[model samples]
Target: MSTPASRPVTAPATALSGPGSPRPYQSYVYAYPHKTAYRPLEDRPALRALWAREPKDALSLYLHIPFCEVRCGFCNLFTRIGAPDELTGRYLDALDRQAVAVREALGDGTPVRFAAAAFGGGTPTFLTAAELERLCDIAEKRMGADLTAVPLSVETSPATATADRLAVLAERGTTRVSIGVQSFVDAEARAAVRPQRRADVEAALGRIREAGIPVLNIDLIYGIDGQTERTWLSSLDAALGWEPEELYLYPLYVRPLTGLGRLGAAGDAAWDEQRLRLYRAGRDHLLARGYEQVSMRMFRRRGAPPSASDDHACQTDGMIGLGCGARSYTSALHYSFDYAVDMGQIRRIIDDFTTTEDFSRAEVGRRVDEDEARRRHLLQSLLQAEGMDVAGYRERFGVVPAGHFSAELERFAARGWLDTAAAPGRLRLSPEGLAHSDALGPELFSPAVRAAMASYELK
Candidate 1:
């Protein structure tokens, strides 16, 4: 998900240690151009034709549930506040229709194998146990993806991670479950516009563990109002107490249209320094506690079951997204239903999606030009702890990453953000560079994409 409005100001590298280091972009560039760059398709294309030549042997499947119990203040994701009356049933009904249409579009000649699957959104667990079972049925019976055979992950919230819902997930072969416990401290949670008691969070975590999901992932946020180093560590220690399989530490981004955005929290030198300090402290603490860094925000407990293949490398494979907030990627284009952050706009889109009869054409998306594709290939791979594989890039694009992104690579190296010497053939970020991933990601964006994303109108 991309924030529809606001991009942070770029700061100099020298500002890292002091009051003026560049504001952390923390952009979470999971996908290139992001959903915000998608525009309505004037001539929607057939899904069959769109994905005809795309590789399908090992694909990733993502299902989005755009309803949450409460909207977090810093959240700019495309999800509505709550599902009222029969909304959940209606949404699932629409999802079933979408699954049927997408499956038909896959064509019968070649089998599309889903290697991994994930359910994410406002809160997937907000649905009833029966509703979740229906969700798994849509994935298994309708789409023909074997949930039991592949690694499946689902996202839940502290308030919604109920035992009944978790049992349904576990029975449906969910290998991992991620819960967002933004803060253990009630005050900090309130500051983030998320209300929850530590007791509830603990209970939810206990329930998830009891559900027997092999991997449990916890998400934490740093840099919220009234959050101090001591308080941050307390939250960290509390999260670590459960010995989660994975942990994601996110920096608070006050983007436009969110509650915090309305509060007018602008990025500044002091704020940047504080966040960086907290981030490093958290990073070092995790490193010393027998966890391995997967990326700037993700840490994995040693020997924990691998959550899933990081095949979000959508540049090379195909993906089928089955909800309003979900984005599907093909070799040439990325598409989804219209995206909006405002609750009214989100509800409108969801309603429209549920009622739609035509699901055969691509509706809203941006064309992935060759230049953009290379940039994506590099961005998705380079941001990982393992870094981009030089051989793999050459095999896929017929050119070395350095040959195409030499100028950008040189600049990053000069600023000590990337280390070509340590990794040899691969391009990897140095520790200092990884801390500024937000800055590094945008700096690599193609000028055309940057402008296109910038000009998109937000609700």
Candidate 2:
């Protein structure tokens, strides 16, 4: 393992220029550029090697269901809208086959102990109750019955989450469900291309709770065109009224090829500073109502149930992303495959399984060294409300964070954006830091990593 080097006397500060600075905050837009570029699978050997190296108990599984009844204009995830019934049936067949193939590729002796399993997509509930049961049966067989105690989470749209679907999920050991309740107001919901009624949203929650599933997470979006502060506040109030175990507050991002992107280009959609102000207001409202800020975009009731604690950041301690288009990372190399339903690439990856061998040890070592310790700490730290644990950092990375990013840390500290304490040794963001957390990633990412990521083409 590499140790953190002592701080140099002089190191440049990498903090982002403030919102209105000449070097506008968008300058860091591609700081952590998408390495896969949404391309098809071409790296099966590396991915398999990563899975093999990961401590079995450290792995987590994510299954993506890409069929949605209606496409939200703001959504850019890999999902098929209005997919044919035959295609849905075929997709489930492919999923089962893929699960079996992964099991075989992982080999028999590898003791894979999953800590968490999540089903996300267009909507996992889009599958029929029987289809979901079959998929669960496959998972139990391949991933093992031992996962019964693990935290299994699934995401669903309110429209798809019927009582039957919830019951199927409960039978499959799912402990939590995340429903996309983008807004409580019907007009705003329809404008965002999510036509769920307020009554339907409440009804879904009532059913999930009645089914005895312990945790319910509601997803809310801010920064949508025509979304007013008053309307947004009302939505937040409605969400709080539901008392979900967790609340995910996300800002709408208009990705390049998404429907929202077209609207923006035509000058029909716009998100300005006022939208950001609304975000801050929403955050304050949630915090005032006793929701703990778990991440930049997530809030949860204090003392949330254990099941809800198995979030992406906490589970990042280790994850074994399976399925097409899933990314897996161990303590060493990071490897991913694209399964965005691109037919040609999927065929190529499936065929390559027979030809490709394990990744070279040297290659794995290179990636580990290339991953800057300070950058990783910052990435994980900013994601949590409690911020970075200095002692934990020293234990894991064998270095003091202050010694690693001394200059940048000092600069932020001086600006009163960062607060550090002794004894337990944790660094947390001050109020100003919380307000600017969205811009922290670009500043903390190493330039070399950013450059390298920018140069990689997905296809």
Candidate 3:
């Protein structure tokens, strides 16, 4: 859920990092125009006007729950560590009000249909079973997303994945439930400041399996301070024992203001090499066990039930994000509430969101012109192992990816990163290319985005 390193700075395309650059593990571009690129709008655009001309069919709906029981060491997502019951209740109430306003904004002029939904954050399962039911209600009755009909995914942590909460999710047709285990070795978990034991993690997995959710996704992190190839494999094997349908292997990134950062532990050349080694080990082990690589961090067991999320690729579809920590995306713009990682600032923003009566207009955002739109499309697609289709790019933009990104593509080819085999019809990363995706993603960032992200105050 957090970016690699969670750093405020970005790599400028002119100085693109390559194999010799100590391996740029400093960024992860899951979505284009990171929230850091956003600025307070001079004139808040009405949501109604924003969606009027955009395609609404196959929209992706996201809800953010910005509360966690505890914060891990390498964390900088837009969530508070702990929130009181009254605060959570207030947050849900605010969510209901916002959902109504957003749904109304997506009028009948365009057919507004959501193909997939996700609840992410500190942890959606942090809410009580009853509260979870209410969350689903807001999505269904207020936002008009048929959660049951659409593929819905929710994120959880080991401590909060209780049977009751899993039951609520299952009943609501949550097709996938991802649990953040971080590590199976108890000492490693503590080293990462995740504060969970192997036994507890096992119990949580058992509960999720019992809940009968179609897809169980286990998330693990490599590159913790003391993590080794042996310990990393131990964690990977432990998670695989559950035969989870999906696995997300993250490289731990300690950024400023996070627990690890405060402790003065930093990523160096050796650490970068260690993470790269462990990543390759984990990737190979999973591939050997019959899992297919979906991206740098994601792997799916072959023939596993597909997430409804697959119906809407985040790169192209319009998305409705309904929380202070979430972001709404359109072809022309990307917007969200103010973002901050400091505890004091996060609570302040959450408080502001809870009391917000006017959800009709966007407060902060970045306008995406044709140049940015094209960059977003290629960056999102080429990072994948499947790569971008030449026809698809041409059909949408009236130009080929090569026509616009010749220099960048040639540089990648020089590094043996781009696969010549796929060139005429498609653009895919070679195995080595996929390994360095974190570096490659930022190389595509527009100069303007780099400047904005560089200036944003992480705190």
Instruction: Give the winner by TM-score.
Output: 3
Top lDDT prediction, candidate number:
3
Which run of 10 residues does model 1 get worst, by summed lDDT?
2-11
- What residue runs in model 1 are displaced by over 4 Å at the alpha carbon? 1-22, 310-314
| Higher-ranked by TM-score: 1 or 3 | 3
lDDT against true structure, model 2: 0.61
Residue 279 Cα positional deviation in candidate 2, in Å, after optimal superposition = 2.3
**Cα-based TM-score, every candidate:** 0.95, 0.81, 0.96
- Candidate 1's displacement at residue 1, Å, is 10
Predicted structure 1, TM vs. truth: 0.95
Per-residue lDDT over 1-459 for candidate 2, one digit per residue giving the tens place of the 0 to 100 score = 000010001112233345432111222121122333222334434345555655564456766666678767766555556545365566666666656666665555666666677777667788889888876876778656334677888888777889898898987788888888888988888777677799988988888888888888888887766889999999999988878888877666554445665576322113436556777898899889888886666788888786633433431345544443344455655544433233344345434432434322112111434245456656667546678777777776677877677876776677666755523577887666655555555556576655644554432
RMSD of 3: 2.2
Q: What 10-residue stretch in candidate 2 is worst by lDDT? A: 1-10
Which is the better candidate, 2 or 3, if ranked by lDDT?
3
Whole-model lDDT values for every prediction = 0.82, 0.61, 0.86
- TM-score, candidate 3, is 0.96
